[model samples]
Target: MAPENSNTEEVVVGEEVGRVRLITLNRPRQLNVISSQVVSLVAGFLEKWEKDDDAHLIIIKAVGRAFSAGGDLKMFYAGKTDDSCLEVVYRMYWLCYHIHTYKKTAVALVNGIAMGGGAAMAVPLKFTVVTEKTIFAVPEATIGLHTDCSFSYILPRLPGHLGEYLALTGARLNGKEMIAIGLATHFVPSEKLDELEKRLVSLNSGDEVAIKAVIEEFSLEVQPDEESIVHKLSIINKCFGEESVEEIIKSFEAEASREGNAWIASVLKGLKRSSPTGLKITLRSIREGRKQTLSECLKKEFRLTMNQLRSVISGDVYEGIRALNIDKDNSPKWNPASLNEVSSEKVDRVFQPFEAELELNIPPEGDAYRWSGKYENSVYPTLKGKQ
Candidate 1:
């Protein structure tokens, strides 16, 4: 049944075929952004399926070139000043929490672009399958937002300082890199996705072994490309492992001066151009995320995000949206524009606890390390190429 009081026609569609319940994001024209309406539609179906015994497993995909671009920026632009906007964000956070600790087996078919909130949806699923056409990123820093959607918990668990590097610079990864970084479970060609989906839906049991067996039948062995950033793990660790953002930038500059590494140069450019306050807070968030539980990370992120929207100390987020989406001018006038002008104290202010009324009411229940420890010691049969 379609959701009522909606202008769109079940833009978020959920249908059951045998034991599989497939949910698709249908807003292709909008790049399938996770708008509030989409959230309501998707969340409603998910809640319904949670009680349906016939829905043995769930598969989420999109009917476009992008699984989802991110949260709807236009909505943010319109409600930047309103407290009600946080209501949608809170809903998204809870949905993410539900996805992480979901009872049923979950699979995400990430065939195209999945950035920011989109990455959050797929990264926590029990099975994440990607295609050559897949592109993944969490470019929140570029828009003066720290990575949210429980990404803080996910990123720090990535190998070495790669998480810190990505959080600060807003780097991107292809499907191959995603597997290398353990973000994706399997890689199948775009052409083979339909066959894989058919096989997955045919499975009557939600048993992990049975599902893995079905997925393994269609998984491919693909190597990361020559120019992959993950290939520069050593350089990434050396620079991003620094104690402070200043030290990291200096390290990058030193490397750029000697080796003239184009990648390092580009990273430096991105960091320097991004909102200074954003870079500082993101670095802190990732560092703290390494120590915190999934629930803790989400709570902290909710506080920080609310702070950004509220603009208690700075309004870079609003400026970023205006520059990037509304004005289309591609220039954000960041307050305290330069990194030198942003102090550690200001960064600390964002992480301070919110009042009881403003705190994210997520239950303490979760499997914090559920996804982490599984892939660390054992390499998947198909992921041998990644080894």
Candidate 2:
């Protein structure tokens, strides 16, 4: 292993078990939320570890109430400039890509909350060990937007209409629900999470085969029941298929009206509660994700978030944050108060990256959407609604 660097910000790293390298996020006060510095440190450590002969596997866990709360909002607030957000988004994109494609198996020991970008990073790992306290979500919908990264690629593939369901509501996935819904690979008592990690490290042959064997034999794997999928498939598939956000909302409302489906009704409530501008942009972003490669998606997200922060152009981001986070009003004074009031100009504005010279680390002349070796269902659904 490379000698420890005293100045490194990546907290801790060392071979925990034969070849399992442990990466514990260190910013406990912020619940280990990733910052610009953390990103650089993570990039350096991951790159070095990937090249080192001593590191065979990597396990990412945190030493706080959350695995990570996601990106540092403070950084965003400090970086009101267009370039500030760009650099931050670039760091996130590269860090996530490194994690997803790492040659060694990566495990996420999600002890508590993992939401938005945090969930994005954890979901792609080979094994996500969740404890009873673990909760996962993408609450960007509540903030008047959708998540970037590969959430588009991973969420819909989840059990039932869980992806879209969570997408619309900003609802959280509890540990039990996460496991039952095919999100968590293993579920254990919250108190035993550390012990379980130790056990995992102790095992010999800690390769994929060994990991799978332990996960199957010891952990209570709450596999998603296919019946749940079939039940919601009809509504989700059709609703998700709608061409626009307006159409999808109308479809959801109409479906609820006609059948009194509790799920659809609840989703409709959430739709009504969200920022119209955010919802429209989110729809566009999801559609963009279906076609773009990973890097392209993140680049698109970077531009989208920058557009979102255009305080001079609109009241969406500031008002949304103030209402949702500052005052906890939960009722934002949106620039365009109604969904019908949201215009094509507003929707289009959110995706327009300000700079002309911005570039992405697109793979050399190849399709960017190229997902590494497929697991099962990685494709974004074309026939949508809830499915």
Candidate 3:
């Protein structure tokens, strides 16, 4: 365990078990939230392991109820006024990109809450193991932030318009649901994770197929529950597939009016309550992500994040955090208070490219790794009246 500070708490612990390099997120009290220190430490470890010939496999897990909640919001809150936080964001995204294109086989054992930045860590790995305790979501929109951390690339590849629904609504998915959606590769019961880890270490070899077989031995055959939102794919595609956020909400409104579905009503309520500008920005990013490669998506997202942090268009992120975390009040007075007030030009401004020197320095496409998952084409039925 490497101590990050004078507090004697090792925020990230790394050790080798045979040929396996294990990384444990050790901040239980903080729900293993990713801080600048955490990103730097993990990135450093990955860089070292990538070169070490003895390291054949990498496994990332956490010590608390949360694998990782997300990026350190308090850090962002503290560095709200200056470009001081950009370095962390740059490094975090680069870390994510490195993991995405990692040379060695990698696995993420997610047994707890994995949201936002946490999801980024797990989803890009070659294999991800989840347990019943795993909870996943990309809920940046709810906090007046666009869905980021390379999700713009990942989400659009899910079957149908599920990505749009997730990005806009911040819907939470359990372990079973995650596997069903191809977001996770295996589902092991929480009780068997330790045994599975030991078995993995005993192999002492970096054969991908062998590693998968061992994981499968401990994994369970599970399915999404009857009440899971995944079952509502047709409705989701019908509603979220719309070109504009306003039109998407309108589709939901139409569905709610026609069927009076409690689910649709709840979705409508959630969308209405979220930041109008965030919804617009997130929707555009997800759509653009459909054609862009992983690197392109990250670059685009970096611009959006920087713009939001710089308050290029508005300071809704700060307001959102202040309302949710600082004041503990649910009410966030979003600028351009309604959807109609959020103009297309304003949305475009958020996605505008930064100058050459200020942009994220991602490695070229040929050097970066591409996801091997079967990316289903995101096609949706045309809305009745809208194009």
Q: Give the TM-scores of the predictions, in the order they appear.
A: 0.90, 0.80, 0.92
lDDT of 2: 0.65
Model 1 ranges with Cα > 4 A deviation? 1-8, 366-387
lDDT, candidates in the order shown: 0.82, 0.65, 0.85
Between candidates 1 and 2, the lDDT winner? 1
- The superposed Cα distance between candidate 1 and the true structure at residue 291, in angstroms, equals 0.4
**In model 1, how many backbone clashes occur?**
0
| Best of the two (2, 3) by TM-score | 3
lDDT by residue for model 1 over 51-163, one digit each (tens)? 68888888898887998998998888788656656667777876787788888898899999999998888989999999998999888888888888899999999999999
Clashes of each: 0, 14, 0
**Tens digit per residue, CA lDDT, model 3, 134-224:** 9999989988899999999999999999999999999899999999999999999999998898888888878999999999999989999
Best by the TM-score measure: 3
Q: Which candidate model has the greater lDDT, 2 or 3?
A: 3
**lDDT of residue 127 for candidate 1:** 94
**TM-score, cand. 1:** 0.90
Which is the leading candidate under lDDT? 3
Of 1 and 2, the candidate ahead on TM-score is 1
